[model samples]
Target: MAKRSFVWGLGRYLILATAGLLAFVAVVLVALRFVNPPTSAFMVAHQLSADDARVRQNWVALEDISRWMPRAVVASEDQRFLAHWGVDVNAIQAALDEYRSGGGLRGASTITQQTAKNLFLWDGRSLFRKSLEALLAVAIDASWSKQRIMEVYLNIAEFGRGIYGVEAASQAFFGISASQLSPQQAARLAAVLPSPKKMSAADPTPYLWQRVRWIQQQMAPLDGF
Candidate 1:
């Protein structure tokens, strides 16, 4: 009888703990909808790491950034950014189909999902982390606007080793503000996003240039969002 009672009590405690955690997360998400985050989980990780170089990031409003910049990233990273809630089911299905057809595995993470990962999670492919990321993405999408998601993503995304955000990246690579970025320059920045550590936006490789051209071509339809 004592064991049964203890089990019941433990179950109730667990349920209450889960509910409290969820409520806390919801409140934070809602608060961040209006308040610009000073730093992100990834940025904090970089600051805490033993790396000698300092992390660079400068927050800019969506309007402060060049229109071409957002369109370039939308074209390169998530073409369906305006449509999806958080997850892109069609992209995931296409990726899975390609995998089934003996193609290399590809990621179909949406902009919101990437933002969620950068804001609250670490680098990993564990199932638990991915699941949590999806939930966070949904919460963020529900709480924030499309423009807000883009603003946070552009600000927090790593553009190079120890360099973050379009503002810092523009200064580091092109000696200009993000607002002054030309279409070609914005495309170059978007090109390095896939492997920021390995790829240099300051010194574009042949493959990087190829990607830049592709992104530029894709940017046409987005019409400088």
Candidate 2:
């Protein structure tokens, strides 16, 4: 009788704990729609680590950032950012088809999805993490505007080892403000998004230059979107 009572008590406790956690997360997500997040999980992690350098980040409004930047990232990362709600089903289908045919695995994460993960979740790929990311992405999309989402993404995305956001990255690499970045400079910054730590906008490798050109080509179609 004692064992069964203990089991029931534990189940009740778990249920309450889960509910409390979900409520907290919901509040935070809703709050972010109005408030610019001062930092992210990645930034916190880096700050906590003794070996990692201190992070550099500056918040800027979407309008203050270059027009080319949004277009470049849309072209380079998720072309369907405007259309997709939280997840891009078509990209997921294509990725699955590629994988089943013995092609290399590809990421199908949309900008919204990446924003959710970077803002609320931790690093690493796992079913659990992806599920959480999907849920939060939905919440973010439901609450935030597309422009707001882009603003948050640009400000929080890690551009280099410690450099965070277009403002810091532009200053560090090109000695320009985020608003002053030229088209070519924006393309170069977007090109390095896939792997910022390995790629450098200041000293572009052959592969990085190719990516820069491709992103520049894509920018034309994305204009005024």
Candidate 3:
């Protein structure tokens, strides 16, 4: 009887602890909807690893950014951004199918998922990390507006080794502010997003230019944004 009682008590404790943690996460997500985060998990990680290099990031309102920038990213990263609810099931299935057919495994993370990972999680390909990222993405999607998610993503996304956000990236690459970025400049910046550390928006290789052109072509359809 004592052994059974101990097991039941431990189960109850685990359940209560899980509930408390979930409640805390809910409260934080709700608060972040209104407040601009001072720094994200990615930024902190970058700073810690940089040894002394500065991480540059400038927060700007959605209105302060060129309309082209958002359209370009939406085109390049997640075309179904406005339609999907946090996760893109079709994209995930497609990626899995490709992997099964002897193709390399690729990511199908949505903008919301990327935002959640950048803001709160570490960089990794582990299943546990992916699951946590997905849960956070759903929570973030439920709490924030579509515009807010884009705004936060644009600000927190890594553009170069130390550069983050449209504002900093634009200045570094084009000698212009994010608001002054032309369509070509925005497309170039968006093109480097897939591998920001390796790809250079300032000096595009032939391959990077191809991505830039593709992103530019895609931007036309999403221009209404």
Best by TM-score: 1
- Cα lDDT for residue 130, model 1? 88
Q: In lDDT terms, which candidate is top?
A: 3
Mind sharing the TM-score for model 2? 0.94
**Which lDDT tens digits does candidate 3 get at residues 82-182?**
98889999999999999999999999999999999999999999999999999999899999999999999999999999898999999999999999999
Per-residue alpha-carbon lDDT of model 1 for 148-189, expressed as tens digits?
A: 999999999999988889999999999999999999999999
Provide the global lDDT of candidate 3 against the true structure: 0.93
lDDT of 2 by residue, 136-212 (tens): 88888888899889999999998888889999999999998999999999999999988888999899999999999
RMSD of 1: 1.1
Clashing pairs in 3: none
Clashing pairs in 2: none
Q: Could you give the candidate ranking by lDDT, starting with the highest?
A: 3, 1, 2
What's the lDDT of the predicted structure labeled candidate 2? 0.89
Distance from true location, Cα of 128 in model 2, Å = 1.5
TM-score of each: 0.97, 0.94, 0.96
